[model samples]
Target: MPRRHDPERRQRIIDAAIRVVARAGIAGLSHRSVAAEADVPLGSTTYHFTTLDDLMVAALRQANEGFARVVAAHPALSDPESDLPGELARVLGAWLGGDRTGVELEYELYLAALRRPALRPVAAEWAEGVGALLAARTDPVTARALVAVLDGICLQVLLTDTPYDEAYAREVLTRLLPAPGTRDGRGPGSLPPPTAG
Candidate 1:
């Protein structure tokens, strides 16, 4: 019989690479290590990923995809009246409290982008996704600024053991938003309709 392609094997290798980065940092990633982690022959890794850079790119893309999904599913992203900052704070707190590994992996990918230009697009994609969600409630400038602020807060939380403070986050985000009744020349108790992406 002619040989058949094993599609899952490629994904398994990518998953193993991510796990390796999460546990040991990107420096520990290697075909041998990923193959061993995935319980596949070392050759399988090379067959799927021609080089370490290729593997890392795949891993970074995968991580970004997961992050986008989490953000997309956030209630605040969908609810116009939801407390955006509070939702962000809650998510950040949960991530810090129990999902440290994922946070670490994400940071690792960001660091990797410093040396690999190819990996930079992955970061841009993440930022764009976040910006689109924020744009729904604010102007483009405010949306961009919010993205930057959110990133700074997340980085600070990751670097230090500071517990996420929802009130503080809300205050910061509120500063970025237009006063409750003034945006787009609307009257009191009004909010701008969400911008369509």
Candidate 2:
């Protein structure tokens, strides 16, 4: 008789690969390391991912999925006309405030893409995910720019352990937002009034 397979084993391996990268960084990741972390046979790692890049890409994609959940939960994103800065600050605070290792792991993949051209598409997908989320609340141009700024701020927080304070987030937003009553008439750079009292 054929042996029964664990239906969740594949996902568990993927989750384990992320954990290994989170704890040890990408340089330490390997099929052997991941198998040890996952407590699975080395064959399982090979069975799931034929190459290291494949494993890293899977981990990056998984991280993106988690970020998407955060974006989906933010209230301001649901209504484009609502106060964005405060809501965005709150959303970012919630995202960056927890789990430093996870944040580090994300930056690891981000930086890795710079050195490895093969990973660039995964990096672009990650950036485009944020851009699309922001576009829900603003025009594509502003969304693209804001995503870049947001990534910078996030990198700062990740590197310096800077407080993910709402005031700081608002300050950044203030610079990017258009002056009130611009000719565009609430399009693109125009933003809702500050929500913070």
* Top TM-score hit: 2
Candidate 2 ranges with C-alpha deviation above 4 Å? 1-4, 179-197
Model 1 residue 159 CA deviation (Å) reads: 1.8
Each prediction's RMSD over C-alphas, in Å, is: 6.5, 4.3
Report the lDDT tens digits of candidate 1 across residue range 51-151.
89899899998998767766665666557766665566555555556678998898788778889988888778878877887788677788898889877
Error of 2 at 147 (Å): 0.4
Residues 69-93, candidate 2, lDDT per residue (tens digit)? 8778875666866667556777777
Q: What lDDT score is found at residue 117 in candidate 2?
A: 76
| Model 2, position 154: C-alpha lDDT score | 86
Which segments of candidate 1 are over 4 A away from where they belong?
A: 1-5, 179-197
Instruction: Evaluate all candidate structures by whole-model CA lDDT and list the values in order.
Output: 0.75, 0.77
What is the clash tally of candidate 1?
0
